[model samples]
Target: MSLEENATNRHGSPAHIQLPEQLSSKFIDRFIRLKTTYWNREYAIVLLAIIGVSITSQQFNTYIKYIDFMNQPNKTENFHLYGCLSYNLFGYMIGLIPGGVLATFYPAHNILGICVAISSIGHVIVIMSISYLNSLTLCILQMCIGTTMAVGDLSIDRVWTYWVPLNKQSIRHVPMVMYLVIFEEGYLRDTMDKLHNEHSSYSLTLFIGVIGLAWYVLWLYVINGNYSFGSLNRDFILFGGLNNSRYSFEAYGNSLTRSIVSDIPWKSIWTSKPFLAIVVLYVCDSRLYQSYYYNTDLFSNDVFEWTMRDNTVVLLLLVVVLVELFPEIALPISTTNVRKIWSCSYFGSLGIIFFLEVILGNTIKNNKMCQYLFKEMRHLYNFGFYVNTLDIAPKYASLLSSFLMCIHYYISDILWASVVRPILSFA
Candidate 1:
């Protein structure tokens, strides 16, 4: 007999039992959004996993920057540093195509899990290599790390394509971008008195690796993504004994989308105007972003002779990072509006870059203002073209994004070698 029936048979009625039961069910339904049929709770999990991977993957960069390798006990020449950087970039470029192809053929979450685990183990090996200061070993490990970085990047893109709903894309990306504001990159330097030893750094890397492995486990079991165990069906159990079987990538994909393998219109996609436009936009977008991120520190030091510890320099960096959050707050509800904002902001940034170089490049205060404006202008991209790859070609977004990245990096490397290097040397 049902609990209500038994209670009623024993007592006069089951009013007390039913009230608590109803309240518990209401609480659970509110917690899981069971009343809302459209929004899946797994989306939040995917975002968290992506954030975890992004933060953990930066260990190499963190170590390289904080170590001040050129002045260290194992002192190396600048040429070696340059070579390491070049090799790392090359590794990422070489892996892009293969990584995209692999993600396309397999389930994205599965590939993501494997890549994160590999990257985690790689962290240990990389730390060991650093102790020896063996250039060859370090270079090879950096290359491997770069390759995993590419694959991990593509996997996350594919997962986002498969998991996040269309209309919710802009708002969902906000958290990841906002994460940068709170995660102060200079915290390592600020806390150097505490984590002062190489061994401490090594231990931290290992701890992060463990966290990354936990992320892998979460993806392996919790997330029901594009393809689950060779089938295109969603079958997963959530907490509170609720079985969630209502969502799948196929159901969420574009209406005209067909079987993944047989339906890819590669020739059309390659030659189409929209795709070509997207490539042009992405190349320019990536170039601007890379230029700022990689060289902004150098620019400040060379032009203004300001160290990172300077009050002005620290404030500038804080302002630049804070500006990244503007788009997330200002983003509109519709994709069309988002696209308009992106176009305006992108062109406006290019104009600011030109104006800064030609007109206002003299004063330190002007430079700081210009840097803040430039960063603020670029982020409409987070809402627009960043997500539009999936919008245009849901099935082929990963492959296409990879191809665009390859092209952009090739162009960037060439420009850096021939144009940027010579100009900076002359200046």
Candidate 2:
């Protein structure tokens, strides 16, 4: 028998005949499930977000260290340091709302690309401004960098909403990423400090710009290839040519129809106890966090006389291990209780450590123990805050988050400007 005839007789279709829908469906299903044992697009996007945040954080550390290094010669009060840091908070205050709004209307990937571009431009400007070193100019550049970083940070949450599966498995990785970034960059800062390279700051800024550009390029490739942006399917393409039909707010049920314009029920949100509680919690946490971060290095150096290498080693042994490993231990337990247990343990331990440090003062020679306790506390606090943000109001999560961040940054900025600066100068 001829092949066609034999095929038709056996399978009810000729061998050469094509069923495009069937073939495409099969291919898509296989592609989605191909790496069931290992990886997927969701994991890829999360990893990219982690890496981008890491690079940006490293750059931030470089900026902080650069300011300190610049001030070493004059032995000034380091007031400019607070000014630079406050400018970052100010930028975050202004940028977060717009970032959240933009993410709602545009593809998150596009917004992310713009953020990275702005960050790169900010880094270049910082490098150029090094010649002048004017406080105003540096503050402005730092603010721009802060704006881009805040926008990119907020945008990542939205991207996760779309890409991450809605399951217990979708725990936030922000705490772990933060710990890793801080640990690695702390080591780098220590090494550079040891070298005593006055020019390292310039080199670090240039390096950050290059990394930002590369991240943007890689993001474009990965997002285009993996995400279904407005029915273009899996084909990778540039941003401008994207079809916006499917990615709109209306498609996502976030837009208000004319009939429902007056039915948004804003009063309930205002009066809701949980909502109010979350807002309060966020503010207090942010304030504490800002104070801790701004003072830790200064306090360690001045009080304990700990070198950068000692601090780095202590953090690596404590925070890095706890933040990276705790999730694994907690994941097997009930989701609702994980945050509670983890948080209580963290704060309780931290409180004890702080009391001991204050009472013992400089007489305590165990720098390693003190450093370990402080690092662990910082990590746990961050992890707890992150978990709380996710747990409250997931449906309006983006709005709640942006609002909380705006408040947090504004308050933190004021506190830093008014209280932290004077204290540091006096110390």
Candidate 3:
């Protein structure tokens, strides 16, 4: 059957009909080809964003090392480290609502470009602050950097929805790809310690800054030259033609224009049992996860006397295993089932790991077997939770993501600052 006929039958025709000959065969061919292409224009955006996220992740994961670098002559206390980290989380909270609003109205690429540029500036500030031994300046810059990362992260869902057609099989893999990117950054930070020591912090900051600036320029070019808001304009040629109903495009475009709070079904969303459940799950998960993540080095040192390198190597291996293995195990199941299973399993495993660490504190010291097992379980759980987010509430994907992330960061930050840091200070 002709593409037009297939679309008409699938979406139902409008009152008016156009001839098949009027359809662009070339466009259709391009779209068909893009369906299979693993690294198309949409994927290019994903990749650039991944790089941006990885840079931020690397900074965060290596904050302890950064702190050591900053305290070249005088040794700072643990409170200083926790305080700097808390500021980043505070910035994450500050960014969410504004990021969501910006993403809803402006093009996602615009938000991304601005956020990336700001983050690059923050990196520069961080390097300078460290050199000058400006503690307050460093804290403020860290917060600003965190906010920029949050904005970029919150806006990413919009890019996926608009740029990648729903029909493509490759779309399903985007979440997994993102997970791998995040974990890879941690791995790189750990493994590249020698390289980082060889070079100055200025070199690292400059490298990340150059990448962000380059991505911003590329984003502007692609969004303006190739794509249009709310319609299949000139750039539809890249995706092959839009075969779906015009209403889909219209709705997407209209969504951007509507007021963020007024346009959304806030009452329905808040009342939604599934949505509420997911929010609760995320809050609990984030609290535990962030606490563990922020204090990973301390936890390893205190519990097992493992160095940062050891912790990072284990984390990297876990990420690799998850990236390679989980999809084969979980993708065959229903998306909802996969989400539930993964989340529950992850939480359970974390709980078990924590229990063991606490209960067998002295006996299991430097126990590589226990550490490896815990790492694998943690990665598996992460794989599941991320993929689940992509599948759940796709229509309200961006808004839902922003809401969940905002709450998650807020709760996690609170726990880290109020509960975790105080205890660490005393210890």
Model 2 root mean square deviation, Cα atoms: 11.5
lDDT of 1 by residue, 147-166 (tens): 88888777666666666645
For each candidate in turn, give its C-alpha RMSD to the true structure in angstroms.
11.3, 11.5, 11.7
lDDT of 3: 0.61
Give the whole-model CA lDDT for all candidates, comma-separated: 0.59, 0.60, 0.61
**Candidate 2, 163-254: lDDT as tens digits:** 56334332344433354445543555565455446557667667777887788667766766634445443323444224364345555455
lDDT of 2: 0.60
Pick by lDDT: 1 or 3, better one = 3
Q: Residue 310 deviation, candidate 1, in Å?
A: 19
Show where candidate 3 strays beyond 4 Å. Answer: 1-37, 56-70, 74-86, 125-142, 165-171, 174-185, 221-258, 290-332, 351-370, 412-427
After TM-score superposition, the amount by which residue 50's alpha carbon in candidate 3 deviates from its true location, in angstroms, is 1.0
Provide backbone clash counts, one per model.
Answer: 0, 0, 3
Error of 3 at 172 (Å): 2.8
Residue-by-residue lDDT tens digits, candidate 3, 1-427: 5667766795655434644533566456655654455446676666665665666655554554566575666764644477678888888878887776666555565566677767766665665556575567677878888888888877776666556544323325544454564454344655547656887755664565666666555565555545654443553323223323321324455554455545668898889887878777777777776656664443454334234335544655554445333435545766557556767887887787678767876323456665555555555555565544454554555677888877765666676689977998999
